[model samples]
Target: MQDAIYAPHWNRNAHSVICVLRGRAQVQVVDDFGQTVFDDELQQEQILTVPQNFAVVKRASNEGFEWVDFKTNDRAQISPLAGRTSALRAIPADVLANAFQLRQEDVSELKVNMERQGNTLLRPSRSSSQWRAIA
Candidate 1:
């Protein structure tokens, strides 16, 4: 959908080969070290391959976004990082605070914000048109 944002997630057991079928999108993939591995704008007919456990997020253009995500497995299990049903929701606030060196209340507030954004795919906010790629 137009302006929609796919939440950051990584497959637990499969690699994904994504082919953009319609519109355009801003895609960002992150490595384990929290460094961005790939970040660029994908236009119609473009394709992107994301390895297992490599977090990926996408924001749709105003024209809307559509794609076919081919996974290695018949049913790929995904773990979302931003959402109400995300892994962050399962961890104790104190644990998260300790791990991030943040206050427990701050961690709690962060979780609340995630919930407010809606689970998984988020609603449209702003349209992005700039194009940049980082290796």
Candidate 2:
């Protein structure tokens, strides 16, 4: 119904990977014991991942800026952005505009299930004798 707001605190389940389309987004990451570690701006076509259990902050670079925010089931307190750190900013409800927003379910379903080389879905390693030596 309304433009989406970036979560204020760190998310436990929703790992975030932000990709800017027409605008920009500032991704803020806080380290363990609650210290700001990452604060950077991502422009169009750039990709970044926020690992689980890390404090993250996202905000549009300018008014009407559009970007896609990927979220998972993990959730953080949905509150007005509150912090004095240079990396985080509280976006007023009016200026937060975007073309599309992906909810947790949408992101969860779209996740890539990459299997390792020797998992159940992959062939197990065979004995060295089974392989012909490279001649």
**lDDT by residue for model 2 over 1-135, one digit each (tens)?**
011235445545567676677666666788656777788876678877766667666655544345666876545322222333212233322233221254544323222111111111111125522211110
Worst 10 residues of 2 by lDDT: 115-124
Which tens-of-lDDT digit does each residue in 29-95 have in candidate 1? 9987878999999989999999998999998898989999999999899888877668887888888
Instruction: State the lDDT at 84 in candidate 1.
Output: 66
Question: Given candidate 1, what's the lDDT at residue 108?
Answer: 75
> Of the candidates shown, which would achieve the greatest TM-score relative to the real structure?
1
Backbone clashes (count) for model 1: 0
Which portions of model 1 show Cα errors greater than 4 Å? Answer: 91-110, 113-118, 125-135
Could you report the Cα RMSD, in angstroms, for every candidate shown? 6.6, 19.6
User: TM-score for all predictions?
Assistant: 0.73, 0.44
Alpha carbon lDDT at 15, candidate 2? 70
Indicate which candidate wins on lDDT: 1
